[model samples]
Target: MRDKLTTIGFDADDTLWHNERFFQLTQAYFAELLADHADHDHLMERLLAAEKRNIQHYGYGIKGFTLSMIETAIEVTEDRVPARVIRQLVEAGQEMLAHPIELLPHAREAIEAVAETHKVLLITKGDLIDQERKLAQSGLGELFDGVEIVSEKTAATYAEIFDQYGDGPDASMMIGNSMRSDVVAPIEAGCWGVHVPHGLVWEVEQAEVPTSNPRFRELKDLGDLSALIDQIS
Candidate 1:
């Protein structure tokens, strides 16, 4: 696999840094705010539904999550969600936007190791400004051969990026925490898809493992990524 691979794509959120935890924290605050209007479990259910519905409209990131929280509040409160609550949600979102980036374990080491021999790419899908901010804060921007902040992660997206940045999908690989976006989609594009499980993953990002796929792989953490590449090579 090493001889066949020329490019490696890494997911931004969760895979490289702390992401879903912040969203979960914000959501807990949201649940507290709506405690009077809706039960905790019910509120969470509605919010997840709203997020799934709004992805097409808002895309992904803090903005969409904030909007979904507001929508869920309004719906649960029979359209009587308080103005204060709305303001608080907006402030919460602003805080999220300004939040600091925290790198995950071995993120830097893994990227540095692979960049030494392969065309390493930071390929992720999210709001442009936020993703750039995180990357800047990460201080690993210069290590990547390229960075692709896309609107979505699909087979087509992987194919286009790999072709542009490396030898193409058959000679590429993608690394991330999400089964749906990182592992499955890239594998579908003829790239190796490596899944490195994270402590907290967004529900929408979860997918059934493609156990039947020869290119599908799982690692406990990014620390083992370099070794996996070497072994496969």
Candidate 2:
């Protein structure tokens, strides 16, 4: 498998470092801020809906999520959301954007191990500024041969990425925590997909594991990635 795989792409968020957990923390804070206006569960549902609808307009990242929080507040409060609450929402997002990067267990080692054998690319989606900042702060910036900060992860996006940086789909593999973005889509693009389960995954990113797909694989953690690659290769 490795001989066939000339390029290995890694998802930057939960796969490389801590990301969704910070978003979850901010969401809890958001619920607290809007507690007087709506129930936590209801507010969360509205926020998710708002995020999905706004993804086309705002794309993905802290900025879009912060906007969604404000929009949800307005909707839940019937447009009576307090000015202070809105300010706090914006502050919460800023705090998230400024948060420090914390690499997940074995992230660096796995990348180093893989990089020794193949071209390693950091393929992530989000606000370009935030993603680049995280990469810089992660101290793993020098490990990757390339970095792709994309707006969305889809089959076409994967295909394009492989076309530019890899030896076509058959010789590329994408590893990440999201089944939708990391596994299914890349496989559909004609590349292998590896799912490394993360402790925290956003609701929107969750999907049933495609265990039946021959090109799909799931690992308990990235620590096992090197061994898995060696086995399959």
lDDT of each: 0.92, 0.91
lDDT of 1 by residue, 118-149 (tens): 88999989899999999999898999989999
Ten-residue stretch with the least lDDT total in model 2: 1-10
Per-residue alpha-carbon lDDT of candidate 2 for residues 1-233, written as tens digits (9 for 90 to 100): 33387889999999989899888999999999999988988989999999999999999999999999999999988889999999999999999999999999999999999999999999999988899999999999999999999988999999998889878878889999999999999999988999998888888888878788888988999999998887766
Query: What is every candidate's alpha-carbon RMSD to the true fold?
Result: 1.3, 1.4
Leading candidate by TM-score: 1
Backbone Cα, N, C clashes tallied per candidate:
0, 1
At residue 224, candidate 1 shows an lDDT of 94
* Per-model TM-score on C-alpha atoms: 0.97, 0.97
Q: lDDT score, residue 186, model 2?
A: 94
Error of 1 at 207 (Å): 0.7
